[model samples]
Target: MRSSVDIETIFATMAVGLVAVASILMTSAPLGAQDGSRSRPVSLGADDRAAALESVQFALAELGDGASYVWHRGHGKLSGVVQPTQSFVDGKGRVCRHVVVLLSAGEKSRKTEAIACRLENGVWRFDS
Candidate 1:
């Protein structure tokens, strides 16, 4: 048998706990999943370019096949998906990543593949 004040306190504690749980869930959810939006055209701003470059470097270092990152293509003015398809060590002992990227603009999309090698300076350069 709880008093009115005790019941109120229990309800308040439960509410707080529920709020904390909701916040945790929201923060842990993926950005795209939370918004329920498909991949859209991304503008290649300075920050976006830096993030895309970093993602590429991370993918190369991890060397995980099918691992992907989002990028923005300036020439096509579209959003792009960059994924590592394969990786190998070259004769010069440089780690190379073969990547495939899909660039999408409006209703059109283009797919391109390239090989990028990790340099001594820790930078990944596309090998043409």
Candidate 2:
């Protein structure tokens, strides 16, 4: 018994609802999953994480700009390259370096950047 206008309005509302649902799904989905181009980096186990962090710290502390060190050579499940991209002295005279870490596990990989500052005690630590 619905009029023609009522039917049209119902269809319009349903269309809008569907569009909203689709928008939500599109935004919530991961970029790699949607595009099939990049896979998200898988998490490393505790030992692997520790090894990677140690290598990253060494690169940040010792490597000059544009120098890179490859890590996880023969033992760990995680492998990566750590490079110091830039270095500068902070206002407090602490040497700070910008480091890039390319980490990979199996077929997944991720690149991360961090700034580490040398402390007064001569230890380099990543900024929190």
- Please tell me which predicted candidate would have the highest lDDT against the true structure: 2
The CA lDDT at 3 in model 1 is 13
Clashes of each: 0, 0
**Candidate 2 least-lDDT 10 residues:** 16-25
Q: Can you tell me which runs of candidate 1 are displaced by over 4 Å?
A: 1-52, 71-77
Q: Give the runs in model 2 whose Cα sits over 4 Å from its true position.
A: 1-43, 73-76
Report lDDT (CA) for all predictions. Answer: 0.51, 0.55
The sequence of per-residue lDDT tens digits that candidate 1 reaches over residues 42-73 is 33344333444565566666758877877654
TM-score of each: 0.50, 0.61
lDDT of 1 at 51: 45
lDDT tens digits, residue span 5-95, model 2: 2222322343222112112112233223434666663333345545655776678777889999997636544577878899999887889
